[model samples]
Target: MEILGLACAAVLLFGAVLSIETRISRSDRQLARVERKLDLLLEHMGLQEHDPRLREVIELLRNGKKLYAIKRYRELTGAGLKEAKEAVERLG
Candidate 1:
């Protein structure tokens, strides 16, 4: 009976965690949608600006320092390694 009680408690805790995770996932989606709309609005208003660090990345790439440029891009943009690599490739 005691073991069963502990198992039930564990199940309840798991369910609570799942519920929180679902809410967080939904919130993240909503935030992403809002950010996209804001970006579009800024673009429409001619207020969207490019990141200045992009120039530094370009310079690094031009100097044949591709690895350094990718690392710098990731740092400046908070992008993952693969995304940074792709972006650097695009710039190159």
Candidate 2:
């Protein structure tokens, strides 16, 4: 009877540990997702890294003034449309 009780207690302890670990992992994932979303929002708002030149470029793109074409962006900033699009996407 004592042995059976010890085994049951051990099983309960193991289950509790597993449950806590799962909850912790889920919390970590949620925190990571929130951080990524904040980064994207800041970038879209042209607030990322606080570069005034980037803000000017973003403004030009927002006004449809065409500061640079896709190819030109690659030439100038070594970034593609994916990077350039982030600047203007928030304005719209």
Candidate 3:
């Protein structure tokens, strides 16, 4: 009986952890979807590809010129400008 109770407890704990992980993953996917939608909207508004300034900023970020990239992005996108700048600084 003791072993059975322990096994049941372990199973419940595992299930709870699995549920939380699944929820987190679902939320992450939803957030990604929203981000893609925003990216598309920005594209439609001509904020991507052709915008030399933004393109340059992204290039700098990709090349690890994070600080400069964030500064330029802040000056351009104005999306979470301060946080984005701080994130780049942290990344660097």
Candidate 4:
């Protein structure tokens, strides 16, 4: 009977820990999404200054290499293709 109780307690503890970890992971993802949205909002409002790396992207655009500019923006900002393309377009 004691052995069975111990096994049950261990199982409960493992489950609780797993549940907590899952909640934490979900919260972290939510927080990241919120942050990304905030960043986009700030950029749209022109409240966020251009990142220094964007200067290079602008130069690429001036050189008539728009695709390279978008690629470089994505590399520098970790932005998706559409986001990077929009950012490059905004530079012009």
Q: Which lDDT value does model 1 have at 31?
A: 73
TM-score of model 3 (CA atoms): 0.53
> Quick one: best lDDT, which candidate?
4
- Estimate, for each residue in 1-92, the C-alpha lDDT of model 2 and write its tens digit: 99999999999999999999999999967876786688788878878455444555655566676645343444556544665555345433
User: Which 10-residue window of candidate 3 scores lowest in summed lDDT?
Assistant: 83-92
lDDT per residue for candidate 1 within 1-92, as digits (tens), equals 99999999999999999999999999967876786687678768877446787999999999999999999999998876876887788678
Model 1 clash pairs?
none
Write model 3 residue lDDT over 2-70, tens digit each, in one string. Answer: 999999999999999999999999996787679768767876887743555566776787898887788
Minimum summed lDDT over a 10-residue window in model 1 is located at 42-51
Runs in model 1 lying further than 4 Å from the true structure: 49-92
Model 3 lDDT vs. the true structure?
Answer: 0.72
TM-score of each prediction: 0.61, 0.52, 0.53, 0.51
lDDT score at residue 65, model 4, on the 0-100 scale: 98
Q: Which stretches of candidate 3 lie over 4 Å from their true place?
A: 48-92
Instruction: State how far residue 34 of model 3 sits from its true place (Å).
Output: 0.5
